[model samples]
Target: MTALSPLDKLMPRGYVRQMLCFPSTSAEVSHTLKTGLARVLADVPYLLAGIITSEDRKHVSLSECYQTLEDLYSEQDISDAIDYVVIKQHHFPPSSFAGPGIIPTDTQPPFPNPTPVFRTKLSLVKGGLILCVAVHHCTTDITGFGALLKLWASHCRTGASAAAGFDPAWLNRKALLERPDTSNRPTPASIPELLHVKGPDELTKIAALASQPSDPTTGVFFFPQKTLQALKHAVNKHIASWGNGGWVSSSDILTALLWSAVLSAESDPMSDRKGSNTIGFPVNFRSRFNPPLPPDYLGTAFIMTTATASRDDLISLSFHAGSSNDDEPLDSASISKLADIASIIRASLHSIDEERVRNVLLYLDGASGDHPPITLGPRHDGVSIVSWADQNIYGLDWGDIVGTCDAVRLPKLMYKRYPIVLPRVPANPAGDEGLEVIVSFDRQVFDKFRQSWPMRRFSTLRYYS
Candidate 1:
């Protein structure tokens, strides 16, 4: 038998399974979930664990695969793992990102925006077709969900849970939330809006960026480990240089990098174009909500840090919040401005009364009654999405259970740069770990931005230019 991941010894050997049921069309998702899904969560990890991992471990990685003696599972375990992956595999109609949940809708949703966590779709292909289901993991963690997927995949190939000895209830989020002080919600300066609990459209501005095909404006960049190192090094230097009087947050750093790219495009002869770009980070309302967002609440824990700038605007954001004296050189001055803006926005987010966000939800929940009230009416234009994921809780042990975390990471890009996620492929059996970015844009915006930072260009450009 293959060695189990370090955390697998504590698994309870069962699964919480959700069928990723896809239909002839998208119209079937709401109809099916409304009629069938009955609980906040139906545990099924045992059944799903086996399905996702192969006996020889060639196709996937079981970061948590070996079976524990205490966690024996069988086909009977299928009923347990249903909550995180949603109720039905959602089908988007042929065009436009809208789906069947809305009125006058005859078609499925247009998977326009990636929603990043859009329904956490689960799929199993067989007999020339596939079955899918969706769930918001606000109910569990990625490790739990990944474990669940393995169970489902295992089940499909072997039909018998006896072979895998898997268990779905293996110390999941439910068990963790029960721990003391897990409610230490992050007091970050920014967070993202949960794409979940909100309606979906085919081409959300964020999705459009994430899915873009080229780097027409970024002037061909490389993202290998070396590049990542250089980025980290550059960041270290940038941070150290800005002693104080700047408002630089992680989100601010991300925004500055991407906006710089957008700014570069504004002056580009071929790709010049003006448009609004935004940045949003996820903020957990765990402390703000009633019952405190289920101790195990897993998916999309965030509020957004949204800031926008048009093509001609020279993103003069400052990092230092203190000195407005502007004694620094012009190039350094620009960076400081960003720092200041970031600090201001950070204050805005911290100031948001937790009670207010909670009240809005409570009011909506009461009006909507038992029905899930998150819906999409119309898609907004020019509002691209940017977010980051944090996974600090997966390291803890839950009495009889334990977990290992692979922290979440997101790709950053300008509006025109659609990033391609490394989906499962032949060379990548364990699958791609993160998203791949490919930048592109109108030549005009590109030209303006290229000239906007002649100072930065001369300094850093000496290396890459």
Candidate 2:
């Protein structure tokens, strides 16, 4: 049995699942879908199995490494249950897909002690098909998920033998664990510290915030290619002023814009207190380490990094709060702020060089396997932006059986404070390339946020009922 690595143990006990909806022209395609998915699983035996945990929660291994087809795939007919368009409208869905219940970590008898960590459910609806796959975070992250999708799509198009071409069994974390640690010692700043809520009061506050009395609403806003280009041009102009800002990617600018917007929408009194609003983003280290990991290093090879700026600085740089005139054009006061935001983000990400990543690996290498939670997301103090821009989610195709990808559905917002950024598929085949950001806030705060011409000028917004 392959053992779970130290990095795997640090993953929060849960699964990150995505619901991909497709337009189905035939109702008799279930068997074909099942066959394709089975082929997909057969090629990746590790994911078709279950996780075995020792008496304590410290150790985990893959057990029952080869299970029956039923263990991996489930099916249900939900044609008359819900509207498919509602799922389509959601740009950035919450993490909880099926329901609100958390996946049980400890063993529970009679119900399958060591359950499968990776699962696929095909929900057949009237006009469309919903393919839901849930894989524990300990098993893989979004990058790995993308790999599975590509392979599954290949299987659906061709057959199991073709799917084997994209199999990732050879890219496990074992190699990372076996590598020697020759990097310098890690300083406190080199490692990520936990910021999980402690005590009953904090939990209660988070629960209350999640379940707002007014029921927070989530909106998907689309940013067109022209707007993105304009923002990049502004950012580049500002970067030219700095002696050495390096190259700021599209994701850097997009994340900086969202971070600034979230800060502007904050209602907390402590938001302006010192470093009240810190922005954190996840850095993918697969290609950043000394001896860079292979492109197929499918495990969790990412680290979360947070950059703190004064609340005033963030708000001043925010699109909504920068210009304060009814007739002011979108570009009046956005250049410097956009530039500043991009600079801060670029600097934070640049700090995670080969040596820095090696230092973090070494630090975790010596830990007790149970390290503190890596903080990422909209915190009580600030907001976190997770960018999946590099992931080819829009390119998923299930052959001619399911036709083209109808829509990528994200879950609903469980927590109103935290938000997600999703790069959406273009409106038409020739429409502008763009991104969709899903955010939740109080009705009043969101109202103020949406009203800002600067925010509205760059994108079109749609709220979920």
Q: Write down the TM-score of every candidate.
A: 0.38, 0.81
Clashes of each: 129, 3
Q: Estimate the TM-score for candidate 2.
A: 0.81
TM value for model 1: 0.38
The regions of model 1 sitting more than 4 angstroms off are: 1-247, 263-281, 287-296, 299-301, 308-330, 367-381, 391-465
**Model 2 spans with C-alpha error above 4 angstroms:** 52-61, 82-115, 160-164, 167-170, 180-214, 243-245, 268-276, 319-333, 369-382, 423-427, 430-432, 452-454
Give the Cα lDDT of each candidate.
0.32, 0.63
Model 1 agreement with the true structure over 1-465: per-residue lDDT tens digits: 122221121121222122222222233322232222211122342222222333442222223333331222111112232221232121111111112221111112332111111122212222111223232232233434544444433343333566433544353323322323434433222212321233455436448756766544432221233333343344445656767633344444433544544444333345544565444433445555444543333322234334544433334331222334434443445544444444544664574445444333333223322333232211223333332123222222211111111111111222363211111111122332222222345455544443434223211221111
Model 1, clash count? 129
For residues 215-255, could you state the per-residue lDDT of candidate 2 as single tens digits? 66666677787778766876786677777745576667777
What is the Cα-based lDDT of residue 453 in candidate 1?
40
